[model samples]
Target: MTSPDDSLQLTATELRMATFRLARRLRCARAADSMSDAQLAVLADLRMNGRRTISTLAERERVTAPSMTNTINGLEEQGYVTRAVDEDDRRRVQVEITDAGAELVVETIRRRDVLLADMLADLDFTEDELTTLREASVLMRRVTDR
Candidate 1:
């Protein structure tokens, strides 16, 4: 009884809700107990995008420079990150992840993967459905990358 457009809208809404639920569930499996979500996000950003200035990180995270600075200060105190003067520009400081930060990211990812894999194993999805889910994940990444 629905138009094709209406069906697409319904599918999109359902997908969004499902993805949110899955993400929240995975958040509980995080390994970095001492890190706040914002701190962890900044660490993950550095790990993925390489070293960046505090201003750049602030813009990426949509927080004020001072707010980002405070977050960075806490992270530094925890020994998860360090700041160094940019070799090419003395005026700018680049925030870099420490070895401990990288290890935290790896452990967090491993925990999430294990949790998700166990949940998937408990599900009764067919191989074809699992393949479709994998394809959907790829498509979702491409959508967000734009």
Candidate 2:
């Protein structure tokens, strides 16, 4: 018999795989054709967290500072983001999403939700299964909240 700890590890692995797959599929539903997934991810983070320094965003995104800088450069060129001297600390530059970037994030989320809903409908899952999924989402959020 599998130990309880082994079973727990198996469940965690399955959860991680399922979450990764769903996120990968949703990533295909972006509103901006010019934006790479990483760029949009940083944009969305900005929209959620407000202004942040490149180094901070880099750490949160698990990327090198230069990579984050490149991502921000792309976003800046497209007018999706702007960089300015931090008022509190002029030595540091902060990045914030432009109104256009926020709109893009909203639209992309809308598209992803629609696609996900349609996919779920096609599954024709029982009510209990759908409820379980909804409950699982809440649990997932709880587990991931930082």
Using TM-score, give the best candidate's number. 2
lDDT score at residue 100, model 1, on the 0-100 scale? 92
Give TM-scores for every candidate, taking all chains together and pairing residue i with residue i.
Answer: 0.91, 0.92
Q: List the residue pairs that clash in candidate 2.
A: none
Off by over 4 Å in 2: none
Instruction: Itemize residue pairs with steric clashes in candidate 1.
Output: none
Q: RMSD per prediction, one decimal?
A: 1.5, 1.4
lDDT of candidate 2 over 45-104, digit per residue (tens): 999999999999999999999999999988998999999999998999999999999999
Q: Rate the local accuracy (lDDT) of all candidates.
A: 0.92, 0.93
Residue 12 in candidate 1, Cα distance off native in Å: 2.8
Top lDDT model: 2
Candidate 1 residue lDDT tens string, 70-111:
999999998989999999999999999999988898889899
